[model samples]
Target: MSRRPFLTLPNSHFFLASRAAAVVTTLAAALVAVSVSAPALAQNTPASSAAAVTGGAATYDTAGASAVQPDDTNNFDARQKDLDRRSTDNNYRYAVAEHDCYSKFFVNHCLDSARNEMREKRAVIRKEQLALDDEQRAARAQKRDEQAALQRAQDAADAPQRAANDARNAQAYQDKQRQHALDQAQRTAEAPQRAANEQAYQQKQRQHALDQAQQGIGASQAAANQKAYDQKQANFQQQLDAARQQGAQKAQQRVENQQHFEQKQATAAQHKADVEARQKQAAEKAREKQQQQLQEQQQQQQQIEQQKQQGK
Candidate 1:
């Protein structure tokens, strides 16, 4: 007879807890990666990756007599700039949270929670931008294909006209060469005066360019000064906001501390009352036992006296 192997159930609660911890750790690491490396990835994501992201049929917008294809390069460049701006904005928000988290009471928990939130926000924006890029690329590709087909048709249709144009262009080129020779002879005769005029014109252009450059430099310096002032103002505002936040946090912490102290005092008072009540009950029970013992002794004494009277 073949023996059957017995199977036992695994510890489900332990298994679940371990799995949950692993998932949380994984997600936390992913959040950190997204926070730190996301901008670099956005900047360097290759065409193949984009193709993978946009793997579907491209749609085109055609209008009267020509297919208007989207300018993929310009659109993507704009999209990249937008993505960079958003990433910078998101990073700023993260920086604020990170600052708070580090300074907060529960540092690790606050930091982890902030990172997780940042990851979610960044992931959503990146995914949306990538999807848009994919769609645009596909549309551009379809437009190019359409344009190629139109060009081929145009080429076929213009074949006869092209031959006639070639003959006319040959005659026109011969006429132009003769005119060019005559013009060259005239130009040689006038070369000295033309050279003098050209040199004066060039010198005037150089002076004008120098004046414009000086103006540009002055404007740039003014703009830089304005930008520096704006930056200083922004920094001051940020510091002021941070100071206010710190004050508010300190006040909140004080309130929480006060509440905690009051709760502990209340609990200690209740525990003391319970202890006193227990002691009083114990004393009452002891007194009742003593009284019952004394009553029993008195009854025995009375019974002995009655027996003595009977004997007498």
Candidate 2:
């Protein structure tokens, strides 16, 4: 209590005291808040958090829904159309490439020079196909003609036998009729004159029967002959038809074969031409390549000299 410094011990001590007081006050306020909210926080934590989370989830769901709302069907269709167009273009390109590589004679040589082994195989197959077609047609015509000639010969050989059998049958029938007429005449004759009359009738009947039989035989023979002639005529007609058909077929086949041969010849000629053209083109390309190489070598020498001069 004397007349000491009324301002306290020192400025530093005062400052430390004030800071400690501020820290204590802050800690006390935090403690008071915790004490006040402890029960309320326990009770409302679930409810409050649930409400907050639910609100946030709803907002997120709305954002997702909005994002998914735009239509993608049109975009998908457009993409599919683009794919189809690309596929079609690829197919067209492949077809054009195939035709360019395989269809023409010049292309054959181009392929050959490229060492495409498949092209040679295809050419061989084509030639074989043409040869087979020609041979098949020729064989068919030959077989048809041979068959027709065989049928005609068989018919001709069978004709006379049929006529002879018909004549025999006619003679047998006439003999039976003559015997019946002689028996009737004998029955009508009287007893005394019967012998002579019967004998005469029998003789006349025999003569008439023989004549009728002979006539019938002749007629039957003639008919058989006529039938044979008709058969012969039919056979002849068949032969003629066969001949005509064979001839026509042969002619047609010949024409087809000739055309095929001509086509093959043409193909060969075209192939030869293509080969020659390829050879000429290759020679020209070689010459051009040689000239280009020579020019490149000269340019390289000039460049080397230029470099050397620059170095100097």
On TM-score, the leading prediction is: 1
- Per-model TM-score versus the true fold: 0.31, 0.29
Question: Candidate 1 has which clashing residue pairs, if any?
Answer: none
Query: 214-260 in candidate 1: lDDT tens per residue?
Result: 77667776566557757866886798699769868865775686567
lDDT of 1: 0.59
Off by over 4 Å in 1: 1-41, 46-80, 160-312
lDDT, candidate 2, residue 20?
54
Error in Å for residue 206 of model 2: 32
In the range 179-246, model 2's lDDT, one tens digit per residue, is 65675466456456746864785576458546655666777776666677578668867986997698
Model 1 earns a TM-score of 0.31
User: lDDT (CA) for every model shown?
Assistant: 0.59, 0.48
